[model samples]
Target: MLYHCFLLIASLRSVVAMETCPTTGMPGIPGIPGMPGRDGREGEKGEKGQPGAVLHGGLDLQKGEKGAPGMMGYAGKRGQNGEPGKSGSSGIAGPPGQPGDPGAVGVQLKAAFSVARGTHEFPQKASIIRFTKVITNINDDYDTESGRFRCRVPGAYYFVFHASLGNKLCVLMKLDQTLIASFCDHRYRRQQVTSGGLAVYLSRNQEVWMETKDYRGMRGQQNGHSIFSGFLLHPH
Candidate 1:
């Protein structure tokens, strides 16, 4: 029995070595890389996630190129009128202007005349000697026939006169019965000449003229040497 048992055990050991067992086999040469397996079935569709947040406080983005303008839209309805605005406050007053310069000198009222008529007589009472010739009479204040100048204004006036006589003669300048000036012949001569002048302020409508109370008559040879003249220097 003992001999049989030993034989059997040795046979069992030989069988194990020759036969392969799944779990205890030697690793084979790396497999011929496997024939690839089929792709897995597609996965189920996933749920949509929440919206992302807006980024801030980062480097500035470059400006994009401008886009083409859009087509114009239709005109809109008219709007209601707006209310009127309130009036503004008044501004402060400005400074006063400077005074203007004195006005220019007034129009000159003046006259100049020469004796043109022949020598004529005069009464003992003062008589006017007519100066028939006129050199200039502004405003026509002097009358050659009347031998009078009617003052048109109340103002200072200047008068000048010259008389020429064939014989002894005397001539006087009267302003409204007031003898303003006079000239008289000095002595018997072929032509005696005398001249007189005056400056006086006369009221409106006062008269001035040449006159002689005691002389036979004034004499003039119809020459410009015998002259009568007056002018307004300034008005009151």
Candidate 2:
């Protein structure tokens, strides 16, 4: 039995060896070389991918919450800019004003007169003495007494003088030393024989007087009369 087992083992080994070294086909001859390949065209674009698809084996995560809107995106890169605006219109003018009032007047007055004084004479009594008005009085009759008359006030002045005797009379009037009028008669009563008006510009401290051109008491019948008055020559 041992002998048979040995032979059986040898036979199985030989069979395994044969199975390991199996026969192959005969070698074939070399084939001809192939031609050069043509140039290749570009590949077609791939389709758009889904919103959140997995890449390789990685997990497909959802997009995060959108943040606040960015500062308005810097004004959208300005368009083809437009031209500048036109200027505004000018304003209207104002109205004119009203007229003004008239102006005021200036100062004026009388001055002086020589009622009975002589302009030229040699101690002639009861002589014809002329009278006239003077802008500046040069005689001694102009008085600046406290309460009497204002011998200084200026304006036009009027003077009158009359010489009277028992029944004889004579009168004279003057303006600015220029004889203006004279009255003489033998038959006369107490009347304005001489009278005249004068316009003068008498300043302060001037003088005026009156004298007997003819007498009425005895020399030519003796006493004579005289007077002076003042008024404004022009409006102020």
Candidate 3:
């Protein structure tokens, strides 16, 4: 019919282009790089958003209500008494005070004796003697009013003599005039006559005297019994 309908429309367009494109010929020049694609599965969590309400849209800022604590503040006026403290640096002179103890040696005394006033039952000059003083003024002790025997403290001095004479008389003790002690022809108070201690070194003016010999107790009744005492010693 028109060529079998144009040969059945060209054989149904060649079987509908060979069932549409079996290897559509003319498209094959890009094939050398194809093995890489496998990692994409994670995306699901998004729902939370609601908090925004503070909008005081104002224009008069007047906070005025705290004004009652202002009535107790009046006591701060005493600050002018601090200017007298500058005298503290004089303490370094205390190491020179230690020496006081040595004062004890002061003793003095004086005395002398010789009393026999009269009755010369036998007298040969020595009225009644006993005297020995002068050891640097021996600490004296016996001065029946200037009978002599004095030395307040100087050293060595001693004298002792006692005598009676109605039948005896010869005792003496003297210094300066020499002769120290002596007794002879004794016999009184039954018999007692002594005159034998005499050592001198008297000072402090010095003095000592005593005498008695005998005319047999000078005139009578025991002429003048001798007697004398004086002493002082401290130097061996």
Considering every candidate listed, which one attains the maximal TM-score? 1
Number of the top lDDT candidate: 1
lDDT of 2 at 7: 100
What is the lDDT of every predicted structure here?
0.71, 0.43, 0.54
RMSD of 3: 23.8
Pick out the ten consecutive residues of candidate 2 with the lowest summed lDDT: 115-124
For model 3, what is the error of residue 236's alpha carbon versus the real structure, in angstroms, after optimal superposition?
26
Clashes per candidate (backbone, < 3 Å): 0, 21, 33
Model 1 CA lDDT for position 171 = 77
Give one digit per residue, the lDDT tens place, for model 3 in 1-236: 67789989998989998899655568878988988989899889888889875445555565557877778888999999998998999888988887755543433333343344334434446453322222233233444444455455556866665555455555555665667666566555554444456667876655666566553342222433454555555632
lDDT of 2: 0.43
Candidate 3: worst 10 consecutive residues by lDDT?
A: 129-138
For candidate 3, give the lDDT of residue 135: 28
lDDT by residue for model 2 (1-236), tens: 99999999999988997888866779999888899899899999999977984565456666667998876655567688689879879768768767544332221233333333222222134433333323334333343221112345544444433332334444444334444555555554554243444444444544333323464321221134333444434322
Question: Distance from true position, residue 85, model 2, in Å?
Answer: 60
**TM-score, every prediction:** 0.48, 0.25, 0.21
- Give the lDDT of residue 94 in candidate 1: 92
Top-down TM-score ranking: 1, 2, 3
- Model 1 — TM-score against the truth? 0.48
Is 2 or 3 the stronger prediction by TM-score? 2
Q: Better model by lDDT, 2 or 3?
A: 3
